[model samples]
Target: PQQPFASSTPQSSNPFGTSSQSTTFSNNSTLNSSNFSNTINCNPTNTMNYNPTNMNPSSNFTTNTFNTFTVNYEDPFLLKDITFEKVEKKTAPFSRIVPKPIFSEATMKPLLNLTYRPPRVTQKKKIYTEPSIEEARHLKEIENLVIGFEGKGRIQYIDKISGTELTTSNIEDKITFLKNEVVVSDPPGIGLNKRARVYVEGIFAFSKSQGDFIVGKAEKYPLKAIQERFVYSLKEDPYKKFVDYNYETGLYVYEVNHF
Candidate 1:
């Protein structure tokens, strides 16, 4: 065996040819080991690691560090510099309010009344009639008009005030009414939909001039002036309810509005 270099220092018994077990072996003999010790001893007690080049192929040497790898790498992101700005504090002035009391109907003079006339209103009351037996049979022939059906239709609709029926050719010109009954809109008492009634430039709105004329007036007339008295029961009609019929006189006394 050759001598080790001057700088080489052995850390333990030579790993090349040494045994950690208590069993002793002849210096010149090879170990026939099925169960061997931890290390081997070469010639010197103080030498560097055993050189792989110096190891004998037939000696069957090994090391635990043969498959290990060591690397040194630096991260680019960790080395970058980051800067941030500082924010300033702000304060706002305080505000306070005292609420007003709620409204009272009694204290407040009515929004509108007899003296205070409301804005003018224009309304169109639509009237629709059901098909009579004779007309219903010719629905397909004369004109097919079903009440309460959506969309305009081609037919005759009555103007309630004039008692005149308008004949319309186009579908859009007809009116849609739910039933034969006319819709008498309740007078709007300034509660809602307070828009003025619009009329054409030349058309006259008779509503503005509505008033009662004093037909006749007498002071304290005697009951003896009427010798005969009569009472009659009139037909109870839902539409003509305000009118009373006199069987003796064959006359109808109606409860009419002056307007």
Candidate 2:
């Protein structure tokens, strides 16, 4: 029987799963048919090649890329609010004041009843009044003192010192003071008539909600130093509080509305 001719290359897997071992005996080695097989004819050029990466594209070499990154920032509230110099004006002056708007009684107390001090009357009397003032002016200014009206909470349209309200015939029942005093109920604002140099003798205290206050001496500010300190504190205080910087008027601005 005539044997088929084959090439001298080593055997390897075909791209297809099955292999043809029927040929390619290197060095002219011949194979005898086993059992009842006949000699076969083979072509040398009919061989196949094997590639492991070809089985799965994932096994091939690859490269990965990414995008460049960037970042940005913005101004903060503290920077926009608290600062070394003046802070940005985000709201109107005294805009933070939320009017108490609490209603006053409608009965309308009597206006400045000096008769209330009957037998107890004294030629020498010590008194403390709101929108605080000195003794001589305090007594004389009682009549002109501002009063709270309807819708206004700071002062009653009556003298707080003497417990008085607008008489039925005051004509519009408005306190005659400051900016269209016809019918407005806002209490009169206060500033000193002259320069005041107070000397605080005891503990000093103040607050925005309560206004300028002193305990030991000048009920509002006992010490001239304390007054200076109070004025400077306005710049530092978070509530935006401040005393009158006007040296001529010597005013202390309380947070109260109408004042």
Best by TM-score: 2
Tens-place lDDT digits, model 2, residues 1-259 = 5454543343466455555454534333355534333334364334366454566867756555466544334653336555576678677557457665568757888888876565755342122234344333325334334322322222222222332322333313333322112223433532211111111112234545547554433334335566557556644645323333443333323222232
Name the regions of candidate 1 deviating beyond 4 angstroms.
1-108, 111-118, 131-259
Which ranges of candidate 2 are over 4 A from the true structure?
Answer: 1-145, 148-227, 233-243, 257-259
Task: Report the lDDT of model 2 for residue 21.
Answer: 50
lDDT of 1 by residue, 71-182 (tens): 4356445443466679887554343244444774456676656686677895534333345434444343223232322221112222112112212221124333222222
Local error of candidate 1 at residue 218 (angstroms):
36
Model 2 scores a TM of 0.15
lDDT of 1 at 166: 17
